[model samples]
Target: TVAVVLFTSDLRLHDHPPLRAALAAADEVVPLFVRDPGVHAAGFDAPNRAAFLADCLRDLDASLRRRGGRLVVRTGPVVREVDAVAVECGAAEVHMAAGVSGYAQRREERLREALGRRGVVLRVHDAVITAVAAGAVTPAGSDHYAVFTPYFRRWSRERLRGTCPAPRTVRVPDAVRGEPLPSRGELSGLSPGLPTGGETPGRERFARWARSRLAEYEEGHDDLAGDATSRLSPYLHFGALSPVELVQRARSRGGAGAEAFVRQLCWRDFHHQVLAARPEASRRDYRPRHDQWRTEDEAAEDIAAWREGRTGYPVVDAAMRQLLHEGWMHNRARLLAASFLAKTLYVDWRVGARHFLDLLVDGDLVNNQLNWQWAAGTGTDTRPNRVLNPVRQGRRYDPSGAYVRRWVPELKDLDDRTVHEPWRLPEDRRAALGYPAPLIDLADGLTRFQHARGRGVT
Candidate 1:
């Protein structure tokens, strides 16, 4: 008998539960990746992510070849492709990792129903993409935890399964047909500053991070200009690195920084569990706030200014510019820009979330959606009414204003305090610099948001 390992988001060879299980249960295994047109039709296949995914697929194929196997590439609907591969290889069992998004859950259900009709057993593995599987820990009453802190406390106590060893040999049938690996240049509209992908590159980064960066991550992660945080979000999103292995290695070091980094990873899982339970959170508010979100047309000018990095707030503009250039933004910048859109402008969170996903290489359904909700005060934030003042946040985080100067060249000559708010400069000086005035008075936006929340302006 043969078994099929259906590759989805989980692309790497090491520490993969579904792949390990499939290899052990059958005489020969088929490693299959399908390029579903549905994802492209839904407009989910952004150029940066497409390039990264191509690199991942090619690297995975190389790894499999080293183990006496190769990846079979197919292009079509996912369920039909899986069935065709199963029948071709004489496979009676199929294995895949569980997913949290609405599209993912629906895909799984369809695959199961289709495979069952054909008399092939389908098994979905949990905790393959995450350090802790969703729904593994729960509060006393709710089906899912709406709050992250309490959920994290419970998650810390749970025991995660040990990482699986990479197989030395993975035998594939000689008759299996396949396609060549895709080239990055074939994808269009890619960001000029996109990073390289694949498990090989990811593993090298992990080694360097563990040796040097991981220790200072806790203290330096929020430094906007320092660029010190681990840039592993894309790798994690693409399954280039195993979350389980990351946690294990971090725990081995056992320091304040390691603990802090582990907590962030836990935050990633926390959002996953929330999304797994309520996929509607991807679009709707997680906890309805009865918010009178401003119309897109009404906030069109403000949003346009924000997106083009002409917000007149240097820090905010710099972050927005970074996203435009790199298809990625610093974590702290993400929080600030999200707040600027949802709270400062009183614009809908969906608009901002959609824009981020369009370019973010690490644009995950769970983290992107829920984090946007948290900043919008419609999700699990304890202080749901909090607003990040761009000026103060910039002054605090980017003390040197180097991050701003790096991305927004117009503000490069401004002095430190003046960097945060260029409009404070004399009209002649500001005009000479060619910087725009403040898009909206900071206090006016704050008052508007406070009134919407049914609270007096601070």
Candidate 2:
């Protein structure tokens, strides 16, 4: 019997549940990937992510070939391509990882119905794309946990299945045909500092970073210039790295850093479960505050300034510029930027989320949208009305102003004390810097937010 392993987000060979199951259940397995036009149509295929995906596909193909098989590529809507491949390969079963987004759910349903009509069974595997399946554990009387603290408690106690090892061999029949693999060189507009992708690079990075930096992550993760946090996100985003393997390995390493890292992963799982239960939260407010948010028309110049990284707040600008260059940002930086746009600027969270999706290589519906909601006070954050003062945040997180100096070169000559607030410099010196003035005064912004939230404008 033959099986078709439908690769979606889970791209790598190691610790992949769907691939393992397909291999065990069939004599021959056709590894298939479909370049769905729907993704591009939905604006999910940003150049940076598309380029990274090309590297992942090529690397996956190379790995399969080494194990006596090769990946089959197709282009079309995912359901159509998958159905066509299953029938052509004479596959008795088609296995794929479960997905949380509404689009993914709809695709899975379409795949199942189409494949079933052709007498092929569609098997969806859980815990392949994520470390734990969404809806695996729930709080009392709820479909999903609404709060991270309680969710984390339940999540910590829920034992996970052991990780799968890579298959020793993958056998493919010669009759299957596929398009040529995509190449990074064929793409444009990628962030100049974007990291290379694929399982090999992912594994190597995890090994090196976990060894050299994981131990100090607890202390250094917030140090903007230190850059000590594991930059494993894009790899994880593409499924080039398995969350199961990562969590297990980190837990075994056994330290406060590992624990902190594990807690962060729980947050990833938390958002997945929340999104799974409430897919519409991707676009709608999860917890609406009746915000009459500013639109592009109402706040065009401010929005433009924010996107261009010239809001005149050194730390926020530095974070935005890093994202523009690297397609990634430090976690702390992301929070500050999100907060500045959603809270201080009082623009709609969707506005900021869309901009992030356009640029962030690791951006996805669950995390990007929900994190924006959290910052905008429309998500599960218990303290929804809180606002991050960017100046205070900068002083606390980027103390020496090295992170500010690195990206805002106009302020490079300023001393550490003044780099974060160069507007404080002597009038002549500040005017010479050529940096834009603070777009909105901090006090005025705060009053605006308070009034919008219906608190007395004190």
Candidate 3:
């Protein structure tokens, strides 16, 4: 009998449980990927992610070919396409990685139901896309944990399974037919600085980061001007690198930095589990915060300014522009920029979340949406009302103002202190600098945010 390996988010060959299971179940395995139109229709198929995905698929196909097998690609509704391939290959079982989003859950159910009609078995593998599968550990009272610290504590104590080995060789049945791999060039409007995809590139990055910076990550991760954080989010988002291996290797090294890095990975899983339990968190407030958020009409121009990186707040604008150019932003930048938009601007969190997804290579429903909620005072933030002061944050994290100057070139001539607030320059100096006046007075913005929350400034 033939076994079909259904590739989903977990695209790499190394440390893939579903692929290993499929290979063990049968002599001939058809590595299949179905491009579901539903994803495109739902707008999850953003251009940058599509480009990154194309690279991953091409890379996975190449890896399979080197082991004497090739990927089988098809397009259409996933259930229909998967069933078609199974029948054509005469496969008796299909194996896929479990996913957390609502769409993923729905697709798994539909695939299983469709295959059941053909008398074929469908197997779903956990911990393929995350270090620990969602729901592996939960608080006693609820289906999911609402906060990160408690979840992280539990996740830390639990033991993880060892990483799986890549198959020595994979054999493809000659009878299978497949489509050509997608070209990333065909994707339009991709960010110019988006990183290359594939397991090889991911492994290389992990190795370099482990040897050079893993130790410093504990103290230096938030040093924005230093650019010290690991640029591994996109790789993990695309499943080009195994989170299981990342945790294992980092733990074996056993340093304070590795522990800190592992904690961030747990945060990733925390969001995943929350999304898994409450898929509506993707578009709705997780806690139903009674926020009288400002309407688009009231904040349209401010939102436009923020999107164009012309907010007149150097740090926030720099982060937004960096995201536009790089398809990624530093973690501290993400928090500060997000807090600026959702808290200072008093805009809806969805607006900022949508824009981030539009440009972020690591854009994911769980992390992006929930993190937005956390910033908006509607999610699990213990101190939900705290606001990030842009100027203070800029001076603190970007002490030299180098990061702001690098991305917001209009202020390039200004020195460190003046760079954080060009509006404070002498009238003639500000005019010559060509930087716009502050879009909204910082005090007024703070007042609006507090008033929106039905509270005065503390």
Candidate 4:
């Protein structure tokens, strides 16, 4: 008997349930990956992620070859490609990891129907992409938890599935043919500092960081200049690192920092469950505020300044520039930058979310759109009206101003005290620095937000 294992977001060999099940059920397995044109049509195929995905696919193929097998790559409609592979391999069963998005759900349904017509069985595995599968633990009356705190509390007690070991030897039939693997160099407009992607690189990164810095995450995660937080997000996003294994390893190490890190992982699951239950929330507001948001026509200049890192708010500019160069941003910087765009600038959160998805290598619809909504006062944030003052946030998070100096080089000569507020410098010195003035007064921005939200300015 033969089986077909379809690789989706869960790309790695380690702790992969779908692959293990396929191997156990059949003597020969076809490891298939279909480059679905539907995804490209949706406009989700940004260059940074495309480049990273190329690296991942190459790594996966290499790993399979090392195990005496090879990945079968196909292109076109997903269902048609999958069906063709199954027929060619004479597969009795097809296995895949469960997905959260509406598109994923629809794809799964179509595959099931298509395969079922051929008398082939489809097996969907849970806990492959996330530690806890969506809808596993839910409120009595709800399909998913709307509040993260409550969800985290429940998620903490649920027993996660045991991790799966990678097959020591994979057997593939030589009859199956595959296209040549893609190269990252074939992709253009990729961020210069985007990290290399692959299961090996991700595991190595986690091992190094978990040993050295996981202990200090509690104290230094928010310290912008320190850059102490583990940069494992891109790996997690691509499923090169399994969430189940990450949680298990972090807990065994056992410290306040490890505990905090686990909590952060739970947030990832939280967002997944939310997206699963409310798929429309990806493009629509989760909790509508009836907001009359500013369009590009009305806020074109301010939006352009924000995107180019010339907002004249030193810390905000630094964060924006970091995103442009590295295709990633610090978590704290993400919050402040998002808040500035959504609340301070009074622009639509969708606009900011679109730009982020355009460049963020780890950009995900569930996390990115919902986070933007949370910052814009339309999501699950308990304090929806809160605003982050970029100046104050810079002083608190990037105290020595090193982060700003590194990214916004024009402001490199300023002292820590004045680096975050260059407009306060004497007229001659400020002009000499060549930094633009603050685009809009902080007080005025706050007042505008308050008035739009129907609250009197304090």
Listed in order, each prediction's TM-score against the native is: 0.97, 0.98, 0.98, 0.98
Judge candidate 2 at residue 456 and give its lDDT: 24
Give the lDDT of residue 428 in candidate 3: 95
Q: What's the lDDT of the predicted structure labeled candidate 2?
A: 0.91
* Segments in model 1 whose C-alpha atoms lie over 4 Å from true places: 455-458
Error of 4 at 291 (Å): 0.6
**Per-residue accuracy of model 4 over 1-458 as CA lDDT, tens digit each:** 89999999988999999999999999999999999988999878899999888888888989999999998899889999999999988999999999999998999999999999999999999998889999899999989998999899999999989998888989998888789987888888999999999898999999999999999999999999899988888888889999999999999999999999999999889989999999999999888877788998899998999999999999999999999999999989999999999999999999999999999999999889888888998888988889999999999999999999999999999999899999989999999998999999999999989888875222
Candidate 3, 1-458: lDDT as tens digits: 79999988888999999989998899999999999888888788888888888988998888988999888899989999889999898999999999999999999999999999999999999998999999999999899899899999999998897798888799888887788888798999998999988888888999998999999999898988888888999889989899999999999999999999999999999999999999999999887657777767888999999988898899999999999999999999999888988888888899999999998988998899999999888888988888899999999999899999999888998998999988889999999877778788878888877776765222
For candidate 2, give the lDDT of residue 313.
95
> Which of the two, 3 or 4, has more TM-score?
4
List pairs with backbone clashes in candidate 1.
none
- Sort the candidates on lDDT, descending order: 4, 2, 1, 3
Q: Residue 369 deviation, candidate 4, in Å?
A: 0.9
10 residues in a row with least lDDT, candidate 4 = 449-458
Clash counts for the predictions, in order:
0, 0, 0, 0
Runs of candidate 4 exceeding 4 Å displacement: 455-458
- Identify the runs in model 3 with alpha carbons over 4 angstroms from their true place: 455-458
* Residue 271 local lDDT, model 3: 92
Report the lDDT tens digits of candidate 2 across residue range 22-115: 9999999999999999899999999989988999999999999999999999999998888888778799999999999999999999998999
By lDDT, the better pick of 1 and 4 is 4
The superposed Cα distance between candidate 3 and the true structure at residue 314, in angstroms, equals: 0.3
